[model samples]
Target: MQAKEIREVSCVGAGVIGYSWALYFAMKDLSVTVYDINEESLQLAKKRIHESLETLIKNNVLTKEKSEELEKSIIYTLSMEEAVRNAQLIVESGPENYDIKRQMVEEMEKYTSIETIIVSSTSGLLITEICKNAKHPERFIGAHPYNPPHLIPLVEITKGDKTSEVVVEVAKEFYTLIGKEPIVLKKEALGFICNRIQMALYREVCDLVTRGVCTIEDADKAVTYGPGLRWGIMGPSLVFQLGGGQYGIAGALKHMGPSANMWLADMADFKKIPDEFAMIAQEGVNEELKNRSAEIGNDNASLAEYRDKMLIELLKLHHKL
Candidate 1:
């Protein structure tokens, strides 16, 4: 019954996502080997991980000795075989090119054992298509993490048509054991689950900006001060359920439907604006970042700190619950 067999983790690309993955795995006390073809990029990746660990330590998120131990737990390698040979979980973070993904997965399958789970950190590529040419398509699945994965908790676990359900369950257990929140999708789509939801909200925000109903700053404030806080505690469904009171969604809809329709209408008008919304949106984003850069950075730092502590607390509470 112990299909939660992940022990060593290997990341094939030592870029931002790869480096972040290495940090997450190593922080979980699993040995991680990160591979990159270019030696300079590999070194930079290692440096970035160390720097982040240092930040964690300085912020009291991780103790100095603990950070050192985690740094020692990770190894950087150029040889793909050496990186993945003993790894039970291998994350492919290469560029989003079909040919490259095919070649890498093919080469990886040649060396990785049958039990090893191949996870794609791809953002857009379909899971089924990526494994179309993989030798062990049964073992290949999508374990897409949010940006700056070391800090974010959500890992969207998706499977292709050929992927085995057992593999998905095992991946979920492995992620849970490593202190991540895994949301499993019953089917695979273009953006999977999280990204699709993210883009839907993003499109609306874009439209809101184009229509001049609110400035770019107003849109972000709408989220950070509203759903963002609630979403931090619970997902959208649960949060809305709580907002619904005892009558559930039906009751809430009766009261809120008119406002929702108005908001949707305003959002729809955004699509009619000439593509000039692109420049406005970009400018708005940049301006918001510039204005809140320092505050946002500090907030992120504190949030990461709180996340680590909260995960520990929740794990302890889970037994009692």
Candidate 2:
């Protein structure tokens, strides 16, 4: 069935991701049932969700009227059977433990229809390995979203080994219908797309400090102010393509190839170094956050409001933002 026809969705686990998923689905006008085993945690999840919606409204990102409607559309439950019984799409976000997921899937399979689409929000675990014995493997897919789901727009939609092309297509359409920038994974690989790239950069940052080339603060500033702005617009490859007549690696090969290769080799050899760099990186991050935590929290509300206002201007400027 098409995603537009899906009217109800069930979210398993009432943790951070679960609450975010509930708000996202409810905002789309879909009835959502959020289930969890812990009664107290579930109450906290409900309270957090309402407060988040209020924050969005205060920021002018979500309307108060719409927020009320979304609250009404959501229902909290502790019964797994009740949550999945009528849901057309089930998103599992339970603990990362493999045994826990296996048990949850085992129970859900008995209740959900064969046609229901089951998506896991796991970051790196192999879905094929986890759901190897699931009843309907074709309907199982990975719908991983980044942290703070309300702010991040990217969603990685990956299909397991036995997942059909139709399942991938439907998942993409489902996410897009809710205004997510979902990308379909051609096939499963370790860390998928974003995380792998993230790790690569992280490795280099570690190496830089290990070799005494720069302090952790310097590396952080380089990425946050330098490549990060361009990355916000496009990937490294596309960014280079627009850089004067040079196109990606070809241009870099002619201009900065020697330096790039040197760094690559340094990174390879630097991995065997001592733990000083790791300590520095960790301390640097902690110190920076410690200095800014209060300021960040103080302005988070107003910043979110400004963000929404700018979004309206952005859409007008681009005519499609």
Candidate 3:
């Protein structure tokens, strides 16, 4: 079915991610059914969903009345059959284990029609293996969202070998319909796209700290005040294109390539992170938080609130909310 034809969607598993997806779908004016096994989880989802709507309201994402109206639009269910029977698309955000995911897929297949498109929210698992035993494998796809999918706009769509091209397109368009930025993966990747880029940069930070080049807090400051600001507006390549002046990116690379290569040579190459780094990183984060002002948040709870508020403002600048 076409993207526009998708009116009813099911979110299988009412954990944080699943409930967030349900909230997003409802906000987009789609009929959403959230399914889970336990009643407590569903109740918790209801509470979180209400709080999330409040966050959106505070961010000016919607008016209070509109939030209330759509808040009641979501239908929560315990039976998988009741959830998927009428859904044109299903987003399974079940446990990230092979056994758990495979079991969910088998159960979802039983209730969902063969023509219904089902997508996994698996971050690192290969879509090929996840749907390998599916009765309707062609209809399965991977649509990994950034954390708190309702707030974040990016969704990475990947297709398994058995997935249909049409399914991929529909998934992309469906995410677009909900005001999200959706990117299709040309080939399967372990960390997909953003995660790999994030980890690569993070690895360099770890290396710099371990070598005494900079402290963890200083590294955070560098990213926050430097390239991170620009990255929010434009990608790195485009920023470099500007840095190249009239010469463009080619010239920038040509001039910087030698130094970049030397740095890359000195960068961390270990497949596994140094185990001692975790404790050190935690200590660094504690110090960093302690150094911050009350306005910016000096603790975890307040810091998260600051982050959400800041993210809303950024998303506003980009016209996402």
TM-score of each: 0.87, 0.86, 0.98
Global lDDT scores for all candidate models: 0.80, 0.79, 0.92
TM-score leaderboard ranking: 3, 1, 2
Extract clashing residue pairs from model 3: none
lDDT of 2: 0.79
Model 1 spans with C-alpha error above 4 angstroms: 1-3, 269-275, 289-321
Q: Tens digits of per-residue lDDT for model 3 on 124-210?
A: 999899999998789999999998898889999999999999999988998888799999999999999999999989988898999
Q: What stretches of model 2 exceed 4 Å from their correct place?
A: 246-249, 268-278, 289-321
User: lDDT per residue, candidate 1, 199-295, as tens digits?
Assistant: 7888878767766778888898999889987776678878767778997767777778999988777555433435777799878866776666453
Q: What CA root-mean-square deviation does each model show from the true structure?
A: 3.9, 3.5, 1.0
Best by lDDT: 3
Give the residue spans of candidate 3 off by over 4 A: none
Clashes found in each candidate (C-alpha, N, C closer than 3 A):
0, 0, 0
Give lDDT tens digits, candidate 2, residues 1-321. Answer: 898878899999879898888888887778899999989978988897898788677656678998888887789998989999999999999988788888888988999999899999988788887688798888988889986565566899888789878888888988888777899888888788998888778877787776778877688779978998678666788776666274555775667778878866656443343556667777776665554444333245644555555544543444322
Ranking by lDDT: 3, 1, 2
Best by TM-score: 3
